[model samples]
Target: MEKDNFDEIIRRSIAIRKKYHELEMTHHGSEWTVEEDALAYLTDAGLVGRDIMSQQLRWPKVGSEAELEHKLGENIWWLIVLAERSGIDIKDAVHNFLDKTETVLK
Candidate 1:
């Protein structure tokens, strides 16, 4: 199996987001919005899934379960983007929260 590396993972995540933009160009080009993206990550990715969710309830899913799971990683990238856009270092924030949780549990 391949080893997991955070830097590489982030790079791959960015690439995945880029592909979303490209696909949107041919499909949802004009209708795409940041709120749509955020909501997609929040609801669709959280519910129907970032992987297999369709553009509509009536349409069939385009991929398999494992492919859908892999795409879910993009949701993490979404939060990372939001944090950066808001001038926060999410890595430090998550570490701080974990440290606080550990202390509370002890």
Candidate 2:
């Protein structure tokens, strides 16, 4: 994908997350706490691992390929949301991580 398209997808993901946050606040009298968000993210992340395992036949198949794909996307969405909520720029964090890892590996 083009850089612009990738950037647009990130932007859209962030916006969708913000919308869900608002909905939660409206319905529950407040949005989820950071810890709750972290736990939710972790739950989905664990599911992704399990999905992969199932696909590999290391575990019984409980989920479909489409579910695995959704879980992966959801994990990325959670990462972006967490970074935004923590006042960090996801793009900068990713770039810094890659640069530092590349330097260390070299």
Quote the RMSD, in angstroms, for model 2: 2.1
Task: Give stretches of model 2 more than 4 Å off.
Answer: 1-4
Q: Looking at model 1, which ten-residue stretch has the lowest summed lDDT?
A: 48-57
Clashing pairs in 2: none
Q: What is the lDDT of residue 81 in candidate 2?
A: 84
- Candidate 1: tens digits of C-alpha lDDT, residues 6-92: 667656665776787788887966635667667766874564343444544444666546555655665678876656545677778
- What residue pairs clash in candidate 1, if any at all? none
Q: After superposition, how far is residue 13 of candidate 1 from its true place, in Å?
A: 0.8
Using lDDT as the measure, which candidate wins? 2
TM-score of each: 0.56, 0.87
